[model samples]
Each structure stands twice: as C-alpha cells, then as structure tokens.
Target: MATVWSVTSPHPVHPLAWLAPHAARRRAAGLRRELRPRAADEPLLDLAGNDYLGLATDPRVIDGAVRAARTWGAGATGSRLVTGTTALHAELEAELAAFTGAEAALVFSSGYAANLGVLTALSGPDALIVSDAANHASLVDACRLSRARVVVVPHDDPDAVDAALAARTEARALVVTESVNSVDGGLAPLHALHGVCRGHGTLLVVDEAHGLGVVGPGGRGLLAEAGLAGADDVVATVTLSKALGSQGGAVLAPAAVVAHLVDTARSFIFDTGLAPASAGAALAALRVLGDEPRRPDAVLRAAAALAAAAGVPAPPSAVVAVVLGEPDVAVAAARRCAERGLRVGCFRPPSVPEGTSRLRLTARATLTEADVALVRGVLAEVLTLVAAP
Candidate 1:
C-alpha cells in the first residue's frame, strides 16, 4: 500500500528589513563604519595597532606559531573543559601567572571574553559593581550581564568609587576599572582606588590590556609595577594581543578565584579554548619581552614624542588621543594621515564623548626616529587642516 501527501513551504521573510532605519540613523549620525581589509605588505607609517612591543611580526613569535600549528592543528576543537584544552594552553596559563606574580591564572579566547567572564562570574544578584565611566566596552557589557547593581562613577575618580561602594547595601561589591583609560590615555589612580576598595571590603578588578605591554618594569604590567600583583583582594586581566603580539587574554587572581572561575565562568566553560598557535606565540613573546626589557621604555618614549609633537602632554601608556572636536573633523584628520602614508586610528562618538571625536595614536617599540619625525610632521599638518575645516 502507498500513501500520497501534498506539502507546501511557507513564504520567507526579509530578516534585516528593520535594520534599514537603524542603519540610516547611524549614517546620519556620522557613525557608519566601513571595513577595509589591510594588505599584507602595505607600506605605511603605522600608529593605529596595539602591538606595543612590536612582537607581532617578530621571527621568533612567528616561528612559535608555526611550530604550534604544525603540532596541534589549526583550531581548538571544543570548549576549555572539554577536548579543547591543550598542554600549550596550560603552559601559557602557568607562565602568565608566574610572570604577573599572581597565585593563579586562567586564559580565554579573547580579552573581551575574559572581561565578560570575570565580571559576570564574580557578580550576581547579591553583589554590587562600582565601575569607572571610562572603562572599555567589554567591562560595560560585563556589568550589564552581571545581574548586579552597577554604579558608574566619573572617570578616574577614586573618591566617587569609594562613595558608590560605601553606599551599597550588598554583602559583596566589586570595583572595576582599567589601569589606563583606553580612550583618553589617562592613567588610573590604582593606589587610591585599591585603598578605597580595601576599606570598603570590596574586591578590585583591574584590566591591564594596555598597561601590560607598555608600562611597568619589563612590561610586567601596571598592577605589578604598583606592587599590587599577587594581592589576595586584587585581580588582573591582561590581553596577549597587545604587548605579546599574540591573541587571547588571561585573568590573574588568587588560587581560589581561579578555581571558582574554572567551575562557573560560562564564557570559559562554553567557548573554545585559545588556539595552540596563539598560546605558543604568546609564550615566545613573553620570553622575548623578558629578554628585551627595554622595549616598553621604547614604546613610552615614542608615545611621549608623539604627544610632544602634537603639542599635548605626554601620555602614560602607548595610546595618545588627539582631540579633533567633531566627527567630520576627526575623519578629515585621519584621512590626511592616510594620504601621507601614516595609518592612524580615528575614533568618534560612543568611543569618545560626543563632540570630542579624536585620532587615537598608538606607539610601537620598533618605530624608528624617521618614523617619529614623519608622524610628527604629518600630524602637524593634520591639526592645521582640521582646525581650518
């Protein structure tokens, strides 16, 4: 016996129709982003990237990545707690903990994920999060996902943080901030903030993404430089992509915190582990940083030189922001830099406060005197051009 049936498929819907108005609004606001993939060998004076130690293209780092890929394949197959965790990942974690002077460490696939993982895991319905207004977007998202009461204090204001923390009725509070304000290139008052947190019985979480490659002795990072490393109450998260010129992030904290994260951090528990090549490259880069301790100093010197040439005060880390006042003006300045074969970063509204759009210049340890002079000269012209425009 046979049976016959008639079937029909439903009409499809346009999935992105609602995005048209949103995209139009963004365009009107001068916030539309365009992707421009860089060439492998673009000849330009570079200042946009966060390769603070200039290790991204180093022979040793490249060799390490190549060796790792050859040994462990190209991708991490599963989550960290599953088939993804490799010997390379474990070694990298150990080395990072030792280097940062933390009792223990955990690694994530990216710095953004690390921030999200740590903040969300540490905070809950019973906790409060006092965060700096100028922290990275990752931390902001983390706070939103934490399901904790979040109080955002003014940028670099430790007193405000203390006040927020003191006012909280929660049993647990976490004070979160960046070692260096990413956009403004301002250094945080970590010593004062830590003091405030300690007095309030709050734990401090510092993101050292920028500071790790360009600050402290031998690029051990600002927490270590501030003598706060390995402190039971302070935890630090650093990105391997910046100074190590690799990819991934690590959280350095007490052993208990590390263990707890291993058990409960959803991001780490579910996300694929960091690729072996990144782990290998990071380890090799760490060794390189140890051998070339002067690289961080070189980066700072370059930042100072860039700031001086721009007629601004020297920035604390490798980031130097040149305020251009308007989105179009900042866009013009960045365009001028590109015209002059200088690749610089252009950040507008949302990245910086409204009406304070600017060019973000990052210093690399390998930049030469000639490169510095060229950047200075080009930026001087850019400043004048934007001023008149």
Candidate 2:
C-alpha cells in the first residue's frame, strides 16, 4: 500500500505530491494515456472511430458545414440563452425530432452535456434512478450528479430494472441505459425495459449515442426500431458526432420534457450552444441518410464481415470488440495493426472491465472490399501475436 502524510500531521506533504503515486500506479499498470494527436494526412486506414455512416469526409457534409460557418461565423458566441441558438440549431432540432419520430428535440454542445442536462433536469428530491452497470461513462456521470437515489443493475437485464423500479420508495423513478453499450457491441432490451417503465410508471432514458444512424430502418435509431419513438415515457439522447459525423448532441422526447429542459438543465442553459457548422453538417447528413436509405445496412454488413474475420460473433452495431485479457496484449495488438498501416482502437483499464481490455474496431459504410481484406489480414496477424507465448 502507498503511504502518504496527512494534511493535519506535523509534516504534511505538498498538495500535488499525492498525484505522483497515482501516476506511478497507472504507469505500472499500463493504464496511463497519452493524448496523442494524429496528422490529417496520416497514411493509415481507420477502424477506430464512431463514424458509422462515413459522412465525416462526405463532400455534401463538408459543404454544409462550410456554408454554415461562412453564414453564422465559427462559434456559437455564447450560451443558447444569450447570443447562441441560431436558426440552424432550431432547424437541426426539428429535423432530428421528425426523422426519429419524436414529438420534440433539444440540441446541446456535446453528447456528454445532453446526458447531464436531461438527468439533472428531470431528477430532484423524490426521484429514483436505476442505471445499467455497463452504461456509458457519460450516463454514469449524469447518474452520480443527479442527486437522486441511484441503483446500478445488471447489464441488459430487464428483470433487474423492473425489480429496482418496483422496489424504489420514490414515486418518480427513471431507468437509464445505453441502447448499445460502448465497450462491446451488446444491446440493451429497450422494448422490454420500456414495458417495465410503463408498468411501474417510470421514465426510461436511453442513450442512443451508439445506435442512431446505425441501427434502425433508414437509421432513425434503436427507439424507432423498437416502436418506442414518440412514446410518452421514453426519452432518448444521441450524439451527432457518431453516425451523423458531426460535433454535437440532442435529446429526443415529448414537448413537455423538452420545454422543461430548456427552462432548467443547467448544462444546456450555461454551456455554449452547438456550433452552427455542426448543426448544418448534421442536418445535411440526416438528409443524405434519408436520400441513401441503404447506409445503415451497409454499416451492419461491414460490421458482420469484420466480426467474421476476427472470429467473433456478429455484433448488433458498428462496434466489433476484440477482447484481449491484458492491457499489454491489447496495446501490442493495436501497435501491430498500426505498423501494417491500419489504425484500430485500444481500450484498456478503466475504459472497460478489469479483465476486458480490447480493440474496439468500428466498421463504416464506406469500407470497400479491398479495405476489408486489408483489415482482416492485419487483425489476423494481431490475434496471432496476442496468442503467442
């Protein structure tokens, strides 16, 4: 165990010295992260991002962003209540609600803020929040900050959710989960969970950050696929950064919930609004998705193919997790892939479960047959290296 002098002791150490032991432990455990920046023109094939629809570099999306920046300037200028909330932001919200079959929508600067906004706004003194154990970090943070009675249940277990809801002493309860888990490609039982919510008169908040633009008919989202869109008790949050290939988020819910969020939700009221460029890009991507309805299927097909190449089961979304038991093994495999001109994601330590370090490979609609072959070859070599003594 590491020892430290107490602040009230005769000889107390400096305030920053406590961080040294934490840093040392992280370094020894291979959990220290270097926020490395990559050059735009790096010669590497990317399987590391959440750009499922491949719109990040689409000419139409670029044109939309450029036009918005030219028209509205680069920044949101201030919080939405102040100089922000442009016509483009309102347009994006309306389009998102219409496309997802929701009654209303509200935009935020990022997905993390959207999650924080809704949870903090909807929760109060007599509220209960039941969260899934494998929920995304954003949702977890929201739960912690909500000031409500929180219970963490098993991953993908509707019975657990129902039990927690039934046992809650608070009359108003909210169950939180991700439509598709971030670490692996496992999906939550949204329909079943919704039924529990309805039965217990609770609200279900699904984070569709990983599902929108990748999981429904025409990529409307998982809620639409489950026939739960526009439901009174269901609220969904999604990031434009993922499938839309932009840089913001939105909450899809009933008009009443949206209105309440606008009035409250400190994160939304205080934080800078979504940039006009991101809003325009997301709107264009939504239109492109509507025009090219086959984009979702293309993403699913690519994910399935990559999973087969990795000798793994087909995942529900674009993420195909290659689990390597240790951080060292996972990092080694990622480096080997990079050496072969392929960029794969390395997830280790607190990002995932203790023994579930992995390579999080995302498949895009734009991947060609040649690109698929190259990825397969690189992954196969990585697996071999990881398996060797």
Q: Write the per-residue lDDT of candidate 1 for residues 1-389, one digit (tens) a residue.
A: 67453435374445566799999998888788899788999988779999988999999999999999999999888999998899998988898998889999999999999999999999999999999988899999999999999999999898899889878999999999999888877888889999999999999999999999688878888888889989999999999999899999989999999999999989899999999899899999998988888999999999999998788889989999888787878887888899999999999979889999999999899988999899889988888877782
For model 1 the local lDDT of residue 86 reads 91
- lDDT, candidate 2, 1-389, per-residue tens: 88665678676778688899999998889888888688999989999989999999999999999999999999999999998999999989999999999999999999999999999899977899999999888888998899999999988999998899888899799999999888897778888999899999999999999999899778888888999989999999999999999999999999999999999999999999888999999999999998999999999999999999899999989999999898988888988999999998999978898989999999999999999999889888889988989
Q: What overall lDDT goes with each candidate model?
A: 0.90, 0.92
Q: Which pairs, if any, clash in model 1? A: none
lDDT, candidate 1, residue 13?
A: 40
Give residue 342's lDDT in candidate 2 (0 to 100).
93
Q: What are the C-alpha RMSDs, in order, of all predicted structures?
A: 4.2, 3.2
Query: Over the full model, what C-alpha lDDT does candidate 1 score relative to the true structure?
Result: 0.90
Clashes (N, CA, C under 3 Å) per candidate: 0, 0
How many clashes in candidate 1? 0
Candidate 2 regions with alpha-carbon error over 4 angstroms: 1-9
The local distance difference test score of model 2 is: 0.92
